[model samples]
Target: MTEQRFREFKMPDVGEGLTEAEILKWYVKPGDTVTDGQVVCEVETAKAAVELPIPYDGVVHELRFPEGTTVDVGQVIISVDVAPGSGPVEAAAAPAPAPAAEPASEAAEPEGRQPVLVGYGVAQSSTKRRARKGAEVPVQEPAPAGTYYASPAAAIQGELNGHAPVAAPAAPVAPAGGARPLAKPPVRKLAKDLGVDLATVTPSGPDGIITREDVHAAVAAVSAPVAAPAPVSRETTPVAQAPVQATPVAGARETRIPVKGVRKATAAAMVGSAFTAPHVTEFVTVDVTRTMKLVEDLKSDKDMQGLRVNPLLLIAKALLVAIKRNPDVNASWDDAAQEIVLKHYVNLGIAAATPRGLIVPNIKDAHDKTLPQLAASLGELVSTAREGKTTPAAMQGGTVTITNVGVFGVDTGTPILNPGESAILAVGAIKPTPWVHKGKVKPRQVMTLALSFDHRLVDGELGSKVLADVAAILEQPKRLITWA
Candidate 1:
């Protein structure tokens, strides 16, 4: 009896060593044909929901776990018959289970690391504790490329943190220069689905990498409505993409929801941040009639066409300007060294309420972007979050954040600081209220702003100034021109 070769698709460590993930869904079943780089299953991690892509072209032999089962990283979740023509399913699958029989450590590092794209590969250096300016930042040398990932989705997917990308079965592509194009597996898959060539798309991502936005832009240039990657509905906040609870217990009025995945991660992080950091919240209510008018005017402006122009856009811009003026407030507490880490750049985080839970993903280098650029980014960020497709890389390195409780019709909230972030600003609902304006009582659009910060890192005066600046900008709507 000859044995057939089966490649076991193990649960990948999608987050930075996130131990386990619950299988949210499976797209392919036994006997289903799967091609290289095709998403076969979706898994929910402590951080985010990620789609697991099969690496090799083959037939699915078996699914080891059912939906909602939490499997440890490196455990075999599915087995694929690489040599599918050999025999029957039962016979082929029986001998093929050897791949899954191996220890997890062996499966994760069986031969060596696989080849990966440049920017999507392991991080070289990350900011850590520093005693002085001269101290060397820790760096991890990239493993020699040429590794085959057990699952490509596990390599790059995370809920609220960033991690490196893994290998894909597709050939590394480049333009006329012969240099390989840098892109994540998901972006590559999107390009393939839309019939857009990654090499032809001009990359707007940092380090000359192609992003999902770049792929969508390529489709936009071709003007193919059918080939567009996402929906036209622009929702600024996260909505329930999937049901949080399924079948209820028999004869029980209360359906118990298991606390795991994104909710579990969120709970733990919130508790840690609350206790670890000394929090102080400050509030200011200001008339934003001018800001509201600016939003309406921008909607008709040609420069702002096709972008998400709303009160939130102006609010985010106001917060950014505030951070610029109070740069010290845009810093983090380095507990390891007990030193203040002042950041020169800003990764502005937007707190979105999703069905999975509250997840905050940030825009990279937000300070350098122009207002239109910021609007475009905000549109993309919200659209991505609403679809539950936000990547781990999008959620990392946030220096500050903005939470709009106004979406829920709430006045304001004392938002807790995101881990490693110094401050969070909450915007309340905007409504017409009786106010004293120009020496007379009149009905005007007004809203309250709440600023919460790590009191250890940000002083009362600094936090107050940041909140005051944001309110001032919204009041005049012209300070954005002078301040920004």
Candidate 2:
């Protein structure tokens, strides 16, 4: 009989330097045939949700973990049977019975490492069943001859000692009051991080599964009373009453969001940027009357038809033009090298708020793109971001960013510089306000612009010039043609 060989696929570092990812979904299951380049699962990293493709064509043998489990990099997540006609036979045969541990002096060494995809490292060691803490060792049952074992550690150790391999014990059952809370691994991790007991959290998901929302809701219920302290008489306050409300109270009085994924990463980046970079913000109120008129004109223009032509488009273009006039503003502070790295090309980032969190996916080569091309790219970027389909690669290498707080009718904000980028421009609401137009008070389209930059790399003079240039272009729409 031909020996059927199985290959294990390890979880790779999908994002740059990402050490772990939560398996959000599984596309292929055991007994399913998959081809090379076929996506097997979707995983959520700190950066984004990415689909992982299988590198080898084979019949899936096993899925090592259930969906929502956060797996470390280089850990095997799936196994595939590669030998021809092995899948049917393997499927037909029942799981091998547990083998009795027996002693033998001569055993074979473990199999050689299998070929893996590029950027994916080999597994550190053969898989082993972790011994449960404080649990009694399970008794091994003897197996019939030629029974295949599942665990490589057991198989190798058994072979080395010339004994039959032992099967791992079934997972322990939860004591009374139904099984352990049914939560996805990520939600469970979030609950653990927030010091929440899953048993106390009420499951809202279908089939009584605990969701991230449920865990967060439980946390909110716990902290709500503290947020609004109700006056209690010393005589009425009892020790037992204090512990009664430890669990989540029904009725939504508050919400506690467990920060993770994009939101968690954004928080860390913002904190680091705010503390590390000395920021200086400069504000300019521009009469964008002409810019708004130009936007209207562009909407009706033959070439600009079907494109997203708005105030943002004009604002983005104005910023690019301003950067061109003041080339020194397009740079980053390299602290390790103690130097300013001036980028010749611009990867302009647009700050987008999605359901997941805030992500800045940039347009590549913004300085090189024509007006229509820029509009198309900007539309695509916004659409992708809104759909939560922005990839990690799209968010990297941003040289400058634009945050349009104006969409929410805010006046303006001193925007924080995106980490590594020198500056970020916040656009305010454009309202018809009385302004000095040609030294005469007139109702004109007015907007506030705030530009914040890394003081280490950009001085007051350079920043003012960049902001002034942008104001000028917005005030006079014809400047785009002259400036270009």
Candidate 3:
């Protein structure tokens, strides 16, 4: 008889202390051959979406949960047959009907499950998780962190002691002729957000998954203005009803989107920051024609070639220079310790608006990077955020942040401070305005900048200097070279 063995891959705690994650997608199906280090699924945690790779090379034996199902950490999500040619596909796919029960001790903590926090691998009796339900496949423990396994994955977050994980909400199914519509959670959420009836959207994707494009097409079709009534040569039947954009659905007057994932985390953080910190906002307007010119010039510079060079790049550099000049403003208030924590390094955060909501992913050691290096980092950060791939780690430990409302064509407004950070700068749209330059009123590219900081950590004098320094640098591009 051929030897048969299976390797089970459990959901690892992708982020520090995250308790669960939703299986956003699956790349492989039963009977599909997979190689080690190949991504088999993508999952969305409370933080961000990440791709999970298989560490074991084998034929996919089964998927324990369907897509859009929220799975708790340490649950076996996929099984793979390590030994090939062991049996027919039918036998491998089906679980044994009358399998023998395992000994009591064998149902202990899984080998592949990882610790959720640093210095947390020690097994305590209080945190003991009950044995999971359904089929169990034994597998080797995962390699330690700092390997490929720990990169970019987010996890479900909650208290782990004596609490059963929350049941995943039912995935919304489009009405497809009394059969369940095939669509992922994100697609369903999109359809609902757009107020487009999924039943009206045609499915063009494989396996009938209603894609985002389909939902958008449906919205476009309904939103297109009714064509003006054309002159008719012959008499046509009088229209029974007036042309309307779209017939109202039976009962969609109100939408209560469940607050979870990134949106949930953001709301909590905002409320905490708002209540805990004392915010003071200061604003200044500056002529940034020279700085804007420098942006265009840098785009042609060989050293900066192939890098993203924009006004934001120069503004970021200006902020770094200002921080360097006013080091005290880079400090955070340690409320519990009753001390101001001054940071020597700057992890400059750029506030980005995503479909999931606002997120601030920082550049580590921004104070150390050269202009070109900073530009490259900014490019990567913006691109990663737009793709919704910003990891939890990328969003942590920010010292200061910048929110550019100018991208939306809005003038500057008082921005809120990111939690644990000293300040946030808001950048407004750059426009051509009449300004006094060298004793003459000329049309100059001007912009408004607003800086909001924690009053306890940064007094008026310190905050003003930081804001003034940035304005000075923007007014004179040479200050970056002189002051930096």
- Using lDDT as the yardstick, the better of models 1 and 3 is 1
* Residue-wise C-alpha lDDT for candidate 3, range 1-484, written one tens digit per residue: 2224667788988888999886655666666788999888878777776778899888887666544456779867887878777655432221111111332233353444333222112221222222223323232222221111111111111112111222333334536554435665445545444444466678999987787678778767867322221322211111111111122233457323345567777889899999999999999999999998888788899999998788888899999999999999998888888999999999999887665666789999999999989989998987677556688899888999998877656778998899999999999988899999999999999999999999988999999999999999999999999998
Q: Rank the candidates by lDDT, best first.
A: 1, 2, 3
lDDT of 1 by residue, 293-394 (tens): 889899999999998788988888899898889899999988889899999999999987665777899999999998899999998987787667887778
In the range 1-484, model 2's lDDT, one tens digit per residue, is: 2333667788998778988776655655566788888878777778876778898888876566544345678877887777746434433221222111232122322243232332222222332222222222343433322233332212222222212243434433442553446665445445543445567777888988887678778879866322212222221011101101122334646433335567779999999999999999999998999998888899999999998888888889999999999999999988988999999999999887654567889999999999999999988986676445678999999999999877666899999999999999999988999988788999999999999999998999999999999999999989999997
Alpha-carbon error at 255 in model 1, in Å? Answer: 1.9
State TM-scores per candidate. 0.70, 0.67, 0.69
Off by over 4 Å in 2: 1-4, 87-255
Q: In every candidate, how many clashes are there?
A: 7, 3, 2
Superior by lDDT: candidate 1 or candidate 2: 1
* Candidate 3 segments exceeding 4 Å error: 1-4, 88-251
lDDT (Cα, 0-100) at 250 in candidate 1: 38
Report residue 296 deviation for candidate 2 (angstroms): 0.8
TM-score of 1: 0.70
